[model samples]
Target: MMVRFRPTILRQYLLQGQLPTTGCLRSQARLPCIAARNRGAYLLSYAPVRAIHSESTPTASNGPADPAFVPLRKLLKDEAKKQKLSGKKKKKNANNQVVEGWELTVGIEIHAQLNTAKKLFSGATTSFNDHPNTHVAYFDLAIPGSQPVFQKETLIPALRAALALNCDIQQVSTFDRKHYFHWDQPSGYQITQYYEPFARNGVITLQARDGIAVEDGEGISVGIKQIQMEQDTAKTLAQLDNVHWVDFNRVGVPLIEIITLPEIHHPATAAALVKKVQVLLRAVDACVSGMEAGGLRADVNVSVRRSDDPSAPLGQRTEIKNLSSFKAVEDAIIAERDRQIAVLESGGTIASETRGWSIGSTETRRLRGKEGEVDYRYMPDPDLAPIVIGEDLVQHLRETMGELPDAEVDGLIEDFKLTPKDARSLVGLNSGMGVEYFWNVVDALKHRLGSSSLADNLPCYQLAANWILHEFGKLWFDEHEDDAARDFGFTEDGQCARVPVDHLADILFFLYRSQITSRIAKEILWAVFRGRVPAEYASVRDVIDTEDLWFRELSDAEYAALADEAVKGQESVVRVFMEKQEKYPQGKLMFLVGRMMRLGPEERIDPRSAERVMRERIEERYIPRLRGE
Candidate 1:
């Protein structure tokens, strides 16, 4: 069976040309088309006339496919036949190819945990702890008939995020019920917005590989479809024994889901977009600090088709879920792209499905059925009132917007004169540390350098960026590390291990301007990690400083003991210095210095005193005698 499509309404004879009887229609060629309704429109009627010679049907090939492919040619033919008989007008792309080659579409949706005191619809305290079920509220447990109450704290921050993204803040928005059944979700439905989200149409900028900063531009617009408040689901813990437990402490936590259109084209762009948004959110104190702790998460929707076909309706879209890091997101997209292109090459249909991100191999595996809007069962929440945002409220929040990551990166580059690489590292590290911590580090350095515009000082910014990225801040991935024990620590009471920003600021300044080497700075941070006073110089600084100042502390006796040992074996040097006192020899003085330096602690003389005494001896004896000649 073969399915064929016509190119234009006026070109009905084009179908005749596509038939096998004509020499123009190659046996190996495949065409895609839509059926027209009017008399002059295209037709989809199949006629099977036995051919004189047996030949294989042609498949779409933008490139070579995988060897293990089974062409699903029968499926496509059957679907095309069915659509024709049903009298349904088919809508196909004007072009036959699917993937876009030249132009790339890119967008991002940042799922940020709100900085709310309580859950969005419940009064449960939203805090991090290692304990299980400590933060679970009755509403979160979805105990049969628990009613939801609304909080303004969650909404305020969502608007703040929308404003930061430069989104169109709607004056009114409502909540909906997004239904999905999972172990984590105690409530069958998630409270979110569908009809009217808080905001729409926003833009974000990211630094590309070429050092060129690109905003989600015209073809790459990151259209923010909606920014809706939602409650987080519980965390699930599965043991090696096959027992699964639910930690509801994370349930009902206030969160905002920022959904974006399918605009991303390249993996690198996707990564940069996610990172930029994450940085901005953290800088504004709009989201939680950690990605693994479910403070931030994302779902990437990807489709691939041939470059020639701009309108060849995109290939089946795949949703890659629960990608916590920017790297993971990029990997998932690459893996999916490979999978989709391979399916097409091998004569197989790309399945619309959801896949899980495997960080270890950076591959995606099929999880379940396809993702669609119908799955969420979105509807308005009856308990909560529609949000009424006033101009005054927007203006009040606007005043709070300080320097975001984009503006700061520009400032760092122009004012501080930092290289792109250095600025990115500093911002990356700073994002991991909360907003207050980052500012404190910058401010403390200014105080130390005694320059009001220290960030603008080239030397000061370079030193500060180095300390923040490599010296003081060490990223912790314990939240991602799997445990084999009884307790699940992703609860409200879980004590998240964070680098204390203020103390970290103190450490950066202490290392800067000091004579401490990079190696010594690492030691100082290690001591701080062990709960020692970060400012305590004796523990860390004393080790290296004591070694450096050893020669300065030497006494007369100590110097004599070392000098006596140094000259014993090298009597030739002494004799030469005396005879050639014709100018006390240069190598002889160097020999004495090297000999004194090599002496062990017990035998070594103080460096300064040894030099002083040696100089005095040379002046009193060698110089006078040499001048006499």
Candidate 2:
């Protein structure tokens, strides 16, 4: 049925959060008529929404303007508030399951240093590791006579990042000075984009691999509120000697702050979203380094709400500032949620504030009360002109920005026929460099090791995925995580522990050709990882040849002789193994083969091949002769 809603009814329904979000609520009329897929078949809009729900206050004359929405408002108003406050919530660590109690809603605000050599509004260079105040200019120090000049080159990578996230670029966006008082920001105000953010309404969907711990983890698309350009403050060092020092080197450095909507329901989801953003930005060369380097950081807003009532208002939220790592992000949200739950259980109301996560305390430390928009006293900057992005520039950037992470993920699944989990795992490595390295190795194998035909490339893809993700990735992230990037690297400079891609390819090729046993390959792997092999032996083949780590299948007579030779020291063990082989086959047989394996000076036999040979000898020859069959 077509619903005819008067302008007053439409306005009241929207203000009371009873209507679905359609699009931007603008000053002008939306359209003469629009198709309503969920609400109704056809809906009419004759007037514009002057402001959003929170922007305009409800007056006395507006007492239940829509009779249909009044019952829902009254029904959920009290119970949802209580559910947010006084119930015990059940969670299994970031799962999206519907708990009987309160639930969490989190949003992320990420500020990343742009990958530019120079400052945003000056000619001074931007350096992270240089001496204090060496890269500063007069304007960076807030000189009286200095003026800001915008750099056009900073927009190249920034636009590439925005477009990579599928954001719609604004044709004209202006700048505003946000007033604040801080020791690091010597200028009384920092320039920002308040009223107009250039890139809006983008999305980053948490991939399948990210949600292996969560229920219904696929396609959780976190909406992007906006992406705005801004300047960074100088570094402030709070010394242990009770003195404060400021370095102006980072002053006026280019920064892009990406604001996300509160669509995240769990701490793990928020971490996944931030990681997705990092990989996306790094893939575009927008932000070169990661959160560990302080090149990108996230501020999360956390709130607890009742899961039973969908129409209930969100609970009081607190902002957790400067969460540097993804694990820190997850831990902060869990900490804040537990804190709010405790406050409500004690008959105390939660307050809005800004907090910081302390790694030592494993909790969120209270920073200050949250600031409102009016506290900033925002105003337009008179010196800078409005940024007008041309259509031609947007087109050029779109053409050269390369394939985005989302598309690349889909391609990996469809083209390579890999599992969705494997595809996302490949993309998440080293901020999207894992997929690049995978392709490089796959291409090398296709040409050098395997046949070039498409039918024969399955082995190449499977081999690359297994070794990179299982072997190299495990060592890269787990055991050698501290120095793996530099020591066992996937970086541009191949100055690692001699386990670069080419050397790894050589090792995999040797194993693929069946010239070396998996154990010997592992020996080579650990040798490369631990730098045990001398640098003089360049390739893995050289090390393998020098160490005599080759595989050879022995004949039946040789296997029988080896088994008889191994029986000398293990006669009692062989009798026990014959008695226990039928019941427990796991450890009994391998014990005999292990003795035979150590009989040689070098590793010349594959353990798997030797186990097969010994098992057959025990079953067909040794068992029958012992039993007189």
Candidate 3:
């Protein structure tokens, strides 16, 4: 049976075209109309028809005697049975086609572990890799008669992040108890700021990307709903045969939950938002922002609605929980969006539930039924008093909030004339430490060169950035191995710690002055990475001398004589250059230059200088012979 809809109404709904609310659908005397309220608007009107069978007459119940009283459930069930009997496959929209009606909406919630030495409200060490439950304290395990206390250090990063995100800092905020039942939650309740959070009403602008390619001049701004400081839950490990173990080490650890408004429409936008948050948290030194290490976690809420009707109510949303990585967040959103679209297309209702992202299969699976706000009976925490952040503290934090990543990137671009890509690369290194190191080396180079500004010397700045991003970054990765290790702690080798900015500056200075070759500069950097540089050698030049890596260029006269000898030896190449002057003059000339560079003195000669000298010889003698002049 075919279901026919009014072309004008259906077209308006399908194309997202606006229609008058009063009479979007025509009222026919024979057909009954059912009005559906959508997003607080009277938007959709449906007319149901009876399915006629070839062998059987339609009954009054099946046809609905009352024109306005159609049973949607029975109609859908009958349609499904009819399709099954006909052995027809479920109709599916083309993969590339925008499901015609649905629009995806996403909101992100991030739990960033605060970088404090001790657990919140306790003196337990917040260190990782300790024995299970080793980091737990009396307050963490909620021992009898134990009371909660506040950690002042946790507020610093949270406030800094708020300021970085341009959130309004709340002077007064209260803590509340969120009650839930879970083995991982030892206290049976969590202390969180539900009634009043620390910060709110902020926005973060993210660069939008089309698939993997970033779109230029296109950005999306998502609102920060709230930021609240809270304690973390313990780690739960389930073994074979339904055996489970709870490690309280993570329990009571400080965390700040950053919740975003449901303005994100694309998965890439959601991922970009999370990555920007990670950078901001790292810039403020509030959170480690390592997804794999449980330093940061994201919960994504996704829903879909009819794109054609702006006033259509959103479809039932599913919450994808504990998405540990940015990629997982993006993938989960995309997968869930497709799943919802398929369900709706197949005439199935979307279920509200909590889902888990299957990293192995890249799909979201049901974790539990969805819970509402009322489920978590929230009340003010009696153990801890309300936090009153004074103007003095806020002003001090604002003052001490070091250079954020955006500002630093702009500075690099404006000062060094670097591309946005290069500037972001430099400022985005080691959570801004890489840029700091680059500038430190630049300062040293400026002082040694007796120059007032490194910016005026563009070559110096470019060379410094290249070395830092390529060579120094490689050395750092080799030592630290992973992002968490590099960001948090160094290895036992102590190589990274030993190489000072001055060492790199001295090496760059030598290269700038042509005192050493690029190859020699790299060798010196390798030596620094390997801890081979002795304390006696105060600079890279000294180390170069000791290692016999210094390559002094030959004098002009000596180079000219060597060029002459190279031309005489490469007699065939010179003849080719003369014969093919009109066809491959430049190429044949470069061949002679290569011969000159290879046959010259042991001293390293610049390739550009060799090319120039070769061109001069060909023009002065070889070209004249070839042209018969």
Candidate 4:
């Protein structure tokens, strides 16, 4: 009767007034750390840390967990059972991502810092350039008396991201505390959406231009598994003198983790998917901070399999963490894939693990063994309530969100007869302003001609796009770089100070309509960009006239004199022209034409007219003389 309630080992330690140290916690080796602040995104750098990997269940060493945490235990148990039953993984043609018989499968988790004005739960302004630790509030420090006050407005950007990806938004989504011990985390746990995320089941279609060929014209689409809003951790600097530097300014900054399905096969497609997501987020004004600015970080999941047997299972996957650039994403995946293939070929087991990219080595190195879900005790957040928004808010966001970059690219191709490269170039300009400017220039050209169509099948829109992106873009980039001459520079305020759209249209109009030669037209355009023009002229014709740049024909006397001088100056060319003896001897006659056009201002005369005069002179003088007449 007295032994009916014998205690278990962990319970005996607890009942004997002794708190057993958590197995995972007992291995902790956290060193004292410091903070750093960066611009653009809240986080600047992540410090290296040894991650804990434990197979056993956690025993109580601290206070009781919120009851809501226990609800997810059953789900974890079920997932474990399912994984045991489903033992293997599988992928695609994968180009060079693998050797001929091997296939590659990759999934990515992108953490993009939101552009909201405030932190997710605190009133601290979400400015990245602030002093380290100055932006943190009491709750951010996990102070006992101060609790997290939810900021409902932060969800607006998260909503935009969901709608942009065409994800199904949950009417209600709850947050959970992911418990882990890291030097950067002031709190023992991180508040995130684990059990029930806000959005799910969307797709992004990739195009051939994105480096992935459209298979049978069906197009490659990457599935959006879920998009969950969560809090970002503090910026951590790599250990210096055995001490870590931490920037609490980034602590609790709002971040949305967008998880993609394991559908990517090629490294190119994986990088493209990340870039497309970046474009989508920026298009919706959700995440304006670019990847270069530390606004986004990606974790790439890579797995490989042998295709010799169709039913053969995929190899274990390795997770490559914190990739900031597209090149890094692709390179890291390639390295990891090669590593796994080597291991499999050598009869070595591929262990599931977490790895890091070494930029200097251009390879991947193991960080730690992958941690299971139970390793991170998911407890319901006791302070923050579930995020709930109405249908009306969703409708409003949908109405306000701009057209996606891909849609704009297709529109440019179909409506304006633009090439894929040209369309993407325009869409990438000035945060979509380039596309708008392109349309404006096209309209201005049409208006000047008083007709929508150009003579001789001129691609009016295509010409405009080329000049804008190629010619102007060249000068624009130069203005920001080693521009010594400062020709066609930006405005004093460090802006592009672009020449008016109509001004560019004028140049395009003059060039296409044959009112001015192509070389002359470019000169006039530069003058306008350089602000050398006395005033903004009404049209290209006006600019040409005001600048004395109009193409002028040679007078009859001038043409005869110039032709005589050209054929006499290039005696060899005339001999070649006469020897050929064909009616025009077109190829040989080019030397004479080029010589005549080089006479001072005669360069402004159209090459066609010069060619005609030179040919006539050659026919009247050189050809007859060679025949011994």
Stretches of candidate 1 off by over 4 Å are 1-109, 209-221, 430-457, 473-629
The TM-score of candidate 1 is: 0.61
Worst 10 residues of 2 by lDDT: 31-40
- The candidate maximizing TM-score is 2
lDDT of each: 0.61, 0.73, 0.72, 0.73
Clashing pairs counted in every model? 17, 0, 1, 4
Tens digits of per-residue lDDT, candidate 3, 1-629, equal 13344544443442344454775434532222212233323232333222111123334433322134445456556766877887975432213223456788888899999888877788788966654554567788677888887877778878888898889999899999999976667689999998899999999876532222142236767899999998999876543333344566788888889999998876777887887888888878878547767799999999998798989777789999998777678778878898998888889998989999855233589989998889998999988888899989989988988778878877887888887777877776766677777777777777888888755677887898988777766766674355543442222222135466777788888888887877778878777655576655656767877767776787667667777887785667777766663466777777777777778743478767777877777768776876788
Q: Which segments of candidate 4 are over 4 A away from where they belong?
A: 1-95, 129-134, 213-218, 237-244, 452-458, 479-496, 514-547, 553-603, 607-629
- Which candidate order results from sorting by lDDT in descending order? 2, 4, 3, 1
- Candidate 3 lands at a TM-score of 0.74
lDDT of 1 by residue, 495-614 (tens): 213334444545555545444434445655555554454344444335446545222245666666666677666656666766763565776787786777677352234445567766
Runs in model 3 deviating more than 4 A are 1-102, 208-216, 238-242, 478-496, 535-538, 554-603, 610-629
lDDT (0-100) at residue 213 of candidate 2? 32
Q: For residues 497-607, what per-residue lDDT tens digits would candidate 2 score against the true structure?
A: 346666667777878777887777777876777665555576788897787777666766776678777767565665665677348665768888887788742355666
For model 1, give the 10-residue run with minimal summed lDDT.
45-54
Give me the displacement of residue 397 in model 2, in angstroms: 1.5
Give the lDDT of residue 346 in candidate 1. Answer: 84
